[model samples]
Target: MGRSFFRRDPATVARELLGCAMLHCCDGEWLGGWIVETEAYLAEGDPACHAARGRGRSNASMFEPAGTLYVYPIHAKHCVNLVTENAGVGSAVLIRAIEPVWGIDAMMQNRNVSDLRRVTSGPGMICSAMGIDRASDAMDVTRADDWLLTGGHQVADRVTQTPRIGVSRAADLRLRFFVDGNRFVSGLAREHTRPRRDVLGPDKDPSR
Candidate 1:
């Protein structure tokens, strides 16, 4: 996938990113996995977004061009996001979870865990497993040789949407997207059950 693939609404990119391979080359070795879960943060009216308070030193990357990496720290761990829309847009898609597929041994070693389910299962884990941190912020994956995002496998009916986790504001907004029945997804059981649209009624559209 190229920059154009991400030059759209953050919600669309988040939903369509499922099953895509995210690879990061480090020290001649590649580490990554299939994206299984993501959350979209809008540039406006999204109180949970980092750019909600206005762009600054820490969130400048979120305002960069599409395909930019906006890595941030939370609770001593890091999370990686892909900037979306045209330049100046603060919207981005957070890669919440991934299914380990490449460099499993390296990922496990980095995470200091032996269980496959624990590796790259969440946003913080994915950053640790892939050696991503503040240094990766603002890097354009669309043009970088070390970072690559390949075309994804369409999940279609298997895709589910739910309220984003770990956010107090806008908690009712169902902006999180994940592959149903995927063991790699990180969240409570209810989050993986069914799409929120089934219960939120047709009047509500969180994708906006």
Candidate 2:
């Protein structure tokens, strides 16, 4: 076993976590995935981060020491991400995407779909498959009980950085990072844009 995934610096941690593995223990089975994408949320005054508005009960994990799990819900449809960083310091790195590695059967079962593309790829889907929720937030990632971030083979290729997704205020912040050619990455990247046919439907008028 290696050291915990909790890092004191969010930016440094985000970059380092790229090729690490996230493990989940469920019902005597072990489920794991490779971290393919991530985003760093800096402390207060960082317009792109949740803690930028100051600490509160909901985001208390942001202040805790690194290696703490910061899980939370977003848009009422997804359990967005987990933050890893120092406690009570408002620094965290969000796990944005993953590539399933261990216990594929159980991951598929948890996701309730068979399509590999839809399982354990996006942040919310990864959370759903790993049994993470608001209740799991702030949990210790170094613990053996439920979730853990473990050391794995380091990523050798250069990572690509992009603007954070789905936010209006910090949309310009290039905090999101991902492996250059990973297909398991979420559709939020620039290359993952919807097909032009979908954007301009067959019957839709071009001037709208």
Candidate 3:
């Protein structure tokens, strides 16, 4: 995908990224997988977003150009997001989960786990699996030779949208998207179920 692919609404990018692949080349070894789940964080009225309070030393990457890597530390681990829209806009798409496809051994080694299912199953695990950290923050994945996002698989019909999990504020807004029935998805069965359009439409204002 090009820079234009990420220069859009965070929710739209989150939904469309369900089947995309995020690959990172580290020390001549490739590590990555097909994206299985994601959550969109908007610049407007989303208090759960890191940039909701405006850019700071920790969240400065969130204010970078679209396609930039926004890595933030949380609970002693790190979560990665792709900055969306134009520069100075704080919106981003958080990659919640991925199905390991390439460099499984390296991913397992990075995560220090033997179970394949445990690898790259959540946001923090993804960062550990791919060796992503604060050092990668603000790097433009679109232009980087080491970091690449590719069209991995087609899963339009298999997509499911629901309210974002693990967020206290704006948790009812349907901003989370994932591939239905993909084992790599981190959310539980109830969490991944698509909500009724009339109840909370996919594009409903998250502030509500």
Candidate 4:
């Protein structure tokens, strides 16, 4: 069985998540991407976090037990975010970017873009390719029905951490991480502030 996404700490889970597979069933077809990057948003008095104000209808999942999928719309586009940590802790890991692996043809059809690099690197693009929408906000990540986080071969050798993007309050947070040198990773030229780590740890094989 695949490692349960709910059984890990939010910080550890965020770092270990790179290269995992995000699968979604759309129109009787399976579409997914390799998780090349992510961002950690802890509830720790973060003004930019929705949970900063405490739980509500839209952000209830953030307060629920870990492993919930918290999808929401940003700038009129849907983005997929995962809830982490224990209930009422209000921590989450935003799936910032992905590298299209399976169903590239289907993703192209959905995005209508010939440039493969632009199809799934950003939050909005990933959602567009995976068919995520506002209706998918409360999805359960551990389920195989509509969405699931599956284990996969970890191909990312170097993971770089940097500040999150487009956030007014948490602009200085060194929480965003990406697979170094991957074409699908965003902001390749930007200087990172945090230390890079081997994505899968020492015990894991480099080639899975």
TM-score for each candidate, following the candidate numbering:
0.91, 0.82, 0.90, 0.85
lDDT of candidate model 4 versus the reference: 0.73
Best by lDDT: 1
List ranges where model 2 is wrong by over 4 Å. Answer: 1-5, 78-85, 188-208
Please provide the root mean square deviation of candidate 4 (C-alpha atoms, Å): 4.9
Give me the displacement of residue 42 in model 2, in angstroms.
0.7
- Arrange candidates by lDDT, highest first: which order? 1, 3, 4, 2
Whichever of 3 and 4 has more TM-score, that candidate is 3
**What is the alpha-carbon lDDT for the whole of candidate 1?**
0.86
- In model 4, residue pairs whose N, Cα or C atoms come closer than 3 Å (at least 3 residues apart or on different chains), thus clashing, are none
lDDT to native, each model? 0.86, 0.68, 0.85, 0.73
Error of 4 at 165 (Å): 1.0
Root-mean-square deviation (CA) per prediction: 7.6, 10.2, 8.0, 4.9
Reference-based TM-score, model 2: 0.82
**Model 1: per-residue lDDT, tens digit, 1-208?**
8889999999999999987888898767788877889999999889999989898999999989999999999989999999999999799999998887778899999999999889988999999999999999999998998888885566767898999998999999999999887878888766666532211011111111
| Candidate 3, residue 130: lDDT | 92
Per-residue lDDT of 109-191 in model 3, one digit per residue for the tens?
A: 99999998789989999999999989899899988888878775778988888889899999889999988777778867565
Which regions of candidate 4 fall more than 4 Å away from where they truly are?
1-4, 155-157, 192-208
